[model samples]
Target: MFSRTFARSLTHTRPSASLSRACLFYTTEAAPATPQLLVRIKADVKDAMRSRDKERLAVVKGILSDLTYLEKSPQAPAQVTDSVIQILVQKSIKRRQESVQSFQSAGRADQAAQELKEIEMLKVYLPQAMTEQEIEDEVRRVVKEQGATGPKDLGKVMKELGSLDPAKAPKKTVSELVKKVLGSL
Candidate 1:
């Protein structure tokens, strides 16, 4: 009788409320949704095609292709998240930058210019980079909070800063800044 009454109450409750309660109790949460960044990038591919913007189309397609490859590989995460996409974009930019340098060295000005354009497009997706002053401020804050003193504490300060701003503070820049701040102590 008690079981019947509880079940009846659940059924009689407002549909939305009952559904939420059922979901919460069952512990069968829905799978994570696709990250919005991936959706936007996919949409841009179509827009580029429609507008006949070959350069934009090429850049977005390259990004999507990289994503597909990663998805199939053993190293792929269970679900592709925005951070994964951002990291991919960063790597793509780095590769293109190197290509630009190579092209410039070879006196291929036109090829180098093309690569620079693609780099600008890719940079749109990444979060704004931290300025030098901002990096210095962050390093100092982390150092103070962690009570780090001298070069010995560099690793501790870096670890905390990484957690705090993984996307904004470029690792190499942050590492250099950390060392500078630590040296002062």
Candidate 2:
């Protein structure tokens, strides 16, 4: 009897219910996972499918295909960052814009309109664009910073503007703004 009591006393006591519960809650339930851009794209793709939205579904599928190609390409980077994905999305939009212009010039209004719709659909993945006045102000700032003298320095000014926030201002918009500023100067 004495040996049994001694053996029981030598063992460690169980953790309190409150302590165990707190630890479990803190470790397992404290921080919820935030979805990455890819996860969000996949979710939107599923939603588009469910809603039977062919336009949106086609755009999302195109984006997924681009991303998948990046993953499979031998020269692809170790990881695809959100910024890279955004750049790809911007390129896709630019391509559609070009096609829209081409179709319009060819007097194909219906095809041009369809391309514009696709551009609009893809733009949901891009960051919000800046206003015309805002873009001009930013371009002026860049021109002054580069000490651009005249039209000859246009390339230098353009190079500086290209380094601006790509999300807020696209390269084409920035170029147009720079041209207007230089024309005045």
Which candidate number would show the highest TM-score if scored against the true structure?
A: 1
User: Candidate 2: where are CA atoms >4 Å away?
Assistant: 1-36, 52-54, 70-79, 97-116
- Per-prediction TM-score, please? 0.79, 0.59
Model 1: residue 11 alpha-carbon error in angstroms:
33
lDDT of 2 by residue, 1-185 (tens): 57987788778668789998888656544553332767778999999999999989989999989988987999786667666678778889889999999999999999999999999888887777788888888878888888886777889988877666676677778887787788888
Candidate 1 has what TM-score? 0.79
- Any residue pairs clashing in model 1, and if so which? none
Candidate 1, residues 1-185, lDDT tens digits: the string is: 57998999988976787788877777567978999889999999999999999999999999999999999999998888888898889889999999999999999999999999999999988888779998899888889999998999988887788675555667888999999989989
How accurate locally, in lDDT, is each candidate? 0.89, 0.82
- In candidate 1 the C-alpha lDDT for residue 27 amounts to 52
Error of 2 at 149 (Å): 2.2
